[model samples]
Every structure is written in C-alpha cells, then in structure tokens.
Target: MSPNPPSSRALPPLVRIEGVTRRFGDTVALDGVDLDVRAGEFFALLGPSGCGKTTLLRVLAGFETPDSGTVSLDGRDLRGVPAHRRPVNLMFQSYALFPHMSVEKNVAYGLARERLPRAEIRERVAAVLATVGLTAQARRRPHQLSGGQRQRVALARAIVKRPRLLLLDEPLSALDKNVRAEMQLELKRLQLEAGITFLVVTHDQEEAMSLADRIAVLDRGRILQVDTPVELYRHPQGRFVAGFVGSNNIFSGHLLPSGGLDVPGVGVLPAPVGVGSAAGLVAVAVRPESIQVAAADAKGGEGLLHGTVLDVSFHGGSSRIAVTVPALESPVLVTASGPATVTAGTPVALSWDPSSAVLVETEETTWKTGGQAT
Candidate 1:
C-alpha cells in the first residue's frame, strides 16, 4: 500500500473537534484544540507525554469531557454521550484481553454485550479473525498467544462491533521490534479493508509516520501542526517541529542580504524558498540523508561546508557519520548509504542541494504553546 491516504477532501469529515479544552486543576491537558478526521482516514495524535493526545482520545471515546469547546462525529454534537453510548471503540495499550477466555470468545464479547444472535456473533467473530490472520489462534487463550496475536485479538474485539470509529492508544507498544513492524502493515491493511476511521495516539514518531494518513503533532495540551507525515518532516513550520519529527542539522542564523542564512560558523548557506526577509533569528533544518559527504580535499568551492569527522557507525544499509564543524554547537549527523570509508579525525566536506533545507523561525512570538495558539 502507498504510505499515504487517498485524497478525499471533498467528502465530509467523520470526526470534528473545535475549540476543545480540558484541564486538570492547575494543568491544562488540551488547549483550544481543533481537528478533523476524514471518513476512512487513518489519523494519529503524535507527541510526548503530557501533550493531551491521550486526553483528546478519551474525549472522543466519551471517557473524558472537555471543559470547553465541542466535539462532534458526523456533524452530530457528542455533548452528553457516555463512553458506552458512543459509537466508538477504544483499544488500550495493554490490549486488555481476558486471560481465561479464548480468542474467539474475546472477539465475540462485544457483540454479546449488545445481545446479538449467537450465529451472527459467531459469523462476525470468525470473519474478523480471518481478516486479522488469526483464524488458527481462535481457540488460544491470551497467555497462549504471542504479543502480536494478542494485539490482533484486541483489535478484533474492538472492530467486531463495527464501531464507526476506532481509537487506539499505543497499540503496538507491547510488541517486539520485528512484530511491531509486521503489525504496522497489518493495521494499515485492516483500516482500509474495514473502512473505519482510526484515530491512534502514539508517542512513537515513526509509528505515526508509518501508520497515519495525517498526523497532529501535540505539545503541552496543544495541537501544534496537523499534516501528512512527509509534509511534517520535509517542511516543519517552526523549531520545535523541525527538531521533533526527524533528525536535522539545525543552524541558527539571520537572513543575509542575498536571501541566504549567515550561519555563525558554517558561513552563508542557501535558504529555502518562500523564506522572505525575517528580522530575527532563523533556523534551518537540513535532513541528514540529504547531505553529501566527500573528502575535504575534493575540488568543490561553492556550496561546500568543511568539517572533521568525529565518528561513523554502520547501520545495515546505511552509515551514520558525525561531523564536527567550526560554527555549529553540535556535531552534524549525516546518513550515507553503504559503508563509510572515512575515519575519526578525518577532514570531510559536506554539500547539499539548496532546496533540501527548510527555513524555520525561532522567534518567541511565533512559538506555539499551551494550546492557546495553533
């Protein structure tokens, strides 16, 4: 499957959150947050702890009420809806499966709660189990199943009722690295096949990038930016997002007369397009993989920044090289494919396409915090 959701902007949103605010005594959990989850869209709330992502998820599931603002599903205000009354299912981080019950029984538990017919429950349970590739494990208890299997069972249980929306909190946190990778693909497939709007809350950036069609980056109970993963990574609007979403070689400088950024130690580097004259400090984030490293003695004058190789580590198909330059406070990280021929203390030259860099303003005035500003 493609790594993005299909364009469906003309369609109405399935979930809408506007001016939502929730607080915990002295602390604000959500600050005037606004968002839209399109129908059949895989959306993610991504941020660090205490960012109010989980709190917002709870609000959607009817487990928590906003102190102010409104939340609606399909244009219907969900003001007084209780957790059990909402047409949404929340799959917790723990999976929360019944230890003694078999997978099939666990999957059918939700259906039974609605007092559905036994044959229909069996049919739905079996169908979902097959969809999740867990038909063979249908009779296995929670303890007898693997971490990934148990997760699938939890998912099956949540989806068996065929809720209009699915809320997953750290859904793959319990699985191992290999299994987690596998489940990422499975989750995406299931979301598409079931045609359910999924709103997942995760602290893992890669998880959000890989799974969501659009991601809302949250901080301190505020939604900072909501965009597709590629857009968030390639074109972050501010310093926090540039540093948060991915590794970047950041340099704080001021705009030069020629529209370039005069980095203190690295000299003037080409500024990204659309970065008009901003009076204050401007920070540029250059992706590690976008940089080209060559021997210092190489015949390149323009667009070249010299540095000393501090370290290099091989990571399967790619190698991460740390280079210490004169002006930058931190060593710039460059990801070069294959093995690195450079050694520690070796002089190196780095060059990148001018367009590869992204301009981000660091002025406090533009900084978004406390969910008060978007």
Candidate 2:
C-alpha cells in the first residue's frame, strides 16, 4: 500500500516507493516501505541516526537497491537503471566541489559528461548560477567562496542537469547554526524557482519542519508518521511520533470516571473530546507551552496541580521550567513567556485545558474508570 491514501487530486505522484525493503547481513535497514512524493513538492525523510533515512535516499538515487520491492520516478520503473542513467541527482553534504575548477565549470560538469554543445552547457550553467544567486561568484573557485556559497554551487550543479528529482543528504549539516538557518530559507526559495521536486534526508526535526511541505518520520527502518509539520507536532498518531517530532510532556494515565485521565497521583486531567470513554488510552502528550504555571500559594483553581520547581532555563522570549509533581514519575516541563519569577525550589501550580492533551495509544492493559478492573 502507499504510505498515504490516494489524494483526491488526479495528478500522479512524481516518485513512488512500494513495499521496499533493504537488508544487510542480519540487519534490516528498510522494512516494507511505501511512499509517494508529489511533483514540485519539497519532501523530507526525517529521523535520528541509524534510522535508514539515508539508505532510502540512496535507494531512490540508484546508489543502492531494495532487497525486495520497486522504486519508480515519473511513471517509469527504475529497477535496472544505473545511478548515472537515472534522471536524478544526489547532492552530498560535503558540497563535493572541485577545488581546482571554477564555480561555473563545476556547475557545468554534468552537462559536459552528456556531451552537450559547449554553448548550451554555458547557457544552462549561467542560467542556473543566476537562479541560485551565484552569478557573481561564477569565476571563483570553491576555495574562494563561503560555505553557503559553496552549497549553492553544489545545488546549481545538481539542478543544471534538469533532473526529474534532486536528492539531498543532510544538505546543511556542514554549516554553522546561523548559516544553516539562512540556507534553509534559501533552499526553499531555490526549490520554488526551479520547480523541482526535492527529497531531503535529515535528522534535524526543526530543519524538516521548516523546509518540508510534508515529512516522513522514520525509526528503526519503519515509518512512524507522515504529515505536515504542524499536524505532526499537534496531532501525532502514536507515542513514538509524539515524542520524536517535538518536545512533549507525556503523562501516563488511565480513563477516569469523569471521562478524564486519572494520572496516578496527579489530579484528573481532561482528555480531548471524542477520545471515547475507552480505557485503552495509556498515555497523553501535551506540549510544554500548553500548560500554564502560577504560584501555588496564590490561588486554588480547578484543574490545577501543585509542584515544586526543580529547574528553570531562560531562552529569550520563553523559559523552560521543570517542576516536580508528586503524581508524575518525572518532572513536568513547562514553557512560559515573561520573566522567570519562579526559581528552583519554589512551589508552583500547573494547569491546562483538557482540550490540549492528546491521547497517545500504546500496548498497555486497559483499566476501566473508577479504578475498577474490567
């Protein structure tokens, strides 16, 4: 089956992976994977190290083949196609520019190999260079440019081929934080202007969230979820997805008599409506910013749980406070704006609307409400 259900639109996906599995020795790198990337879309394969994201990208680029399954691009099966013969370009993280060659020559390398006319190659090279905002640096060698400029050169080289797809492996991993952020925007803009489908492999959740139209979260050779960044962050389908895509304060609880969650020692927290009064919910995840914190002694309020502040970290506009609550196995993290008026060892109260808590399903025994065994 496709990773996602067929869309209502009639346009076919530009790239497709069906039941693809790759294994090395006794280890499985990809397990029965299926995916569809739409044309002109900026898609991301996001996961942590050893998650087989890069392996899948390599498979699409023709550097590696799945042990069992098929990959196709623009309606053609790529089973027997060699890497060079495939109409896809893979850009490495290192930028891989030739130090001895000028920027324009580097960008024209692929076209030269195809034995294109010199005038056509020059025209394409110049046009792509200008598209990437690297026209001024055309005559400069790789060593003469900044890291971001070198990356653009590499991007220009890949796009000059006018390939059906462009595969990037950790494209910004080599840049500093500031430069990385700038390039993220630049890369997105470049993709739009070129109108090329980009499949980027990354371990950085924030990068994937910022650059991709849709992201596929992979873990241990399996896809956990595929959704827009906001959807994945706010409405994750399962526990793994809730924890992986963003930072969340997860509470383990059972269904309560009032249709809320009876979190062990913590007070009953309301669950989002429509979760059903089922006892199958084993956990609920709430973003730190969703919970409100105040001084415990100031007022007694409904839905409020008291705790002692364990630590507070300030990050310009927001502060991350960890509070030790008796009902929780670990400190509950809260992100608040304004001053850090609450310090370590201070008593605080945390409260949040039930609507903010997301039910996360897990493989746990179900317990009925009122502490009754079903």
Candidate 3:
C-alpha cells in the first residue's frame, strides 16, 4: 500500500491580539490578553463565567472595542473597522436565526445585504447549504427544525459570506449530548473544507478539549495558560489548570528533603520537581489513572500509602474507587482498567509512580480537605 499523506500543520496566525484590555465601568473584562489564531486553525478561548472569553470573541467580531491595546487581522489594525465592514462573521449562542425567514433565506441574508447578483446569491447559498448538509431543509423555518438543524443553518449563514475568519460563541451549548458530538465532528469538517480561521469561546472544557487545536484558559479577565490540549492536561502550569482541565487527586503539604511532599497519609512521595527550602507551600497533582491498587506487597514500589476502599463506581470501560487513607481528610480517586475488584471497606495499598505526580504552585482555590493538591 502507498504511504499515507502527511497531515497538514497549522499555518501562521491570521488574527492577533496584542495587550488587549476591555473594561465596563470599574470592572475589567479583558486584561492585557494577547492571543493569536493561525490560518485555518480552530482555536478556543476556554474559561468559566466572567472569565472574559465572550468579551474577547466580541472584540474579534468588531461588536466591541478594547479600551487599550490593538486587534489586528492579517496584519491590518481593526480599530476603525465596523462590524458590518469586517471580513469576519460571528455565530451566536442563541443561533440568532430570523424566525420569519426560511433556511435558504437566512443563509442568503448576508449576501442579499451586499446586493450580490440574483443568480450568484442563489449559487452561493446553495453551496454553503450543501456544505452544512442543510440543503434538504432549505425551505424549513427555524421553529420547524431541530436544535442541531438550526445550528447548521446558522453555520451555513456565517460561512456564506466567505469571510477570512469565523467567530463562534457557544454554538453547541444548546444541543443535546448526542447532537453535540455530531455537531463537533461536523464543525471540524467544515473548518477544514472552508480553510478559514475559527475562534470559539466556551466555558465547557470538554468542548474545548475535543475541538481546539490550541486552548487559551482564561480566568478573571487574564489568560492563565495557552497550549495544546494534551500538554495542558499532562503538564498543567498550576493548581487551577490541573483542576479545571480534568479530574485530579491533589495533595497539599510542605516539600520534604527527600524530593517529595510530606502528606499526612501519603508520607514522602516522589514528585516531578524538586522543591527547595525557599518554597514553603506546595501541591502535588496526579491523575486518577496514575494511581494503582495492589495487594499490599507490590515489589519495588516505594512510598506506598495504605487506605480503605470507601466507595466504588463502575463507569463502563473503567472502574473508579475512592480510597481513604489514614491521617488524610479527603478520599483519593483511583482508576482501574476493568471492573472494580476491591469492595468498599476493604483494605488496599494505594501506590503510584513518583514520575506520575506533578508539583504545582499552591493556590488558595485548591480542593479543600484533600490529601492531594487540586
């Protein structure tokens, strides 16, 4: 068989944000946030509510202006560009479809406003409808269609303008679980087909993890960290990133001389980084999968902590167990490959490789009462 073609890498950024800051009265919405969205790449701004993700999207779409700093697209400053004149389109969370217009008319609305030729407008609308798989429902109104179908119509409308950039503000938040998954795949395919830079804003970590080429995790109007999904998960910069990205078992304690954090129950467990005497408080983060349960005598295992199985949950492919170690205030979650062999109230030895645990800077918002750091 012929060798498969190499997958395409990201091109240079087409949109750039430099020291962007936006404020509403005394409240800062975006605080010196700097970001770049590469050509044809799907980038996501991820954070919880009031984190400035939506504000950044609005800035990019020309719906809002920054109080300080600059917004540029293709190296051109967008300070004076009005929303209607910018070569960008935004798909809102509400789908924002005109209830009075049919699917075909909604998709063609932008082109019609530009006063395009009659035949050309119809051709472009038909093309975008086909791309979003909405051609069959072209005559249906927004109320007549399902949530996912309405979303596709919105996407078709956004792309019909042939803009260089696309902005999506929680476009999939309204759909059900199954439809959300389907739309995620469809959106990825559409971005690849259109070759336009896509910037999405979402608080849903799973959506950002699944769809983004690179994610910018924001907090309180500041960009905390930006990296690929796997890098963000495997090596979080701090306690917030670790806890926000996925489930983690965190321990808070002082670093001991033996290159481990001295938790009450876990003792001196090996850590990924060395903490000198200068660092007073430290937190250790380890994914549930990194934890292992053995029969009290696993060879070559150091820093073994003995705990009793407090609870067990079967989650189809894997089993999750909450084990409570003596001297620890909270239970540590452990994941096993198959069904849970250990029952609640059973004694078990909980151990993990020293390399699996990541040492992070302690934050006040870390998990309370947990032996591990959040």
Work out the TM-score per prediction.
0.93, 0.92, 0.90
Best by TM-score: 1
Which pairs of residues clash in candidate 2, taking residues 3 or more apart in a chain or in different chains? none
lDDT of 2 by residue, 122-189 (tens): 89998999899989999999999999999999999999999889999999999999999999999998
Give the residue spans of candidate 3 off by over 4 A.
1-10, 256-258, 264-266, 273-278, 295-303, 362-374
Please give the clash total of every predicted structure, in order.
Answer: 1, 0, 5
Off by over 4 Å in 2: 1-10, 277-281, 298-303, 365-374
Which regions in candidate 1 have their CA more than 4 angstroms from the true location? 1-3, 297-303, 362-374
Over the stretch 165-224, how does candidate 3's per-residue lDDT look in tens digits?
Answer: 999999999999999999998998898898877889999898888888888999999999
After superposition on all C-alphas, the RMSD of every candidate to the true structure, in Å, is: 4.0, 4.4, 3.9
Which residue pairs clash in candidate 3?
250-372, 250-373, 251-371, 251-372, 251-373
Residue 208 CA error for candidate 3 (Å)? 0.9
lDDT of 1 by residue, 167-214 (tens): 999999989999999999999999999989899999989899999988
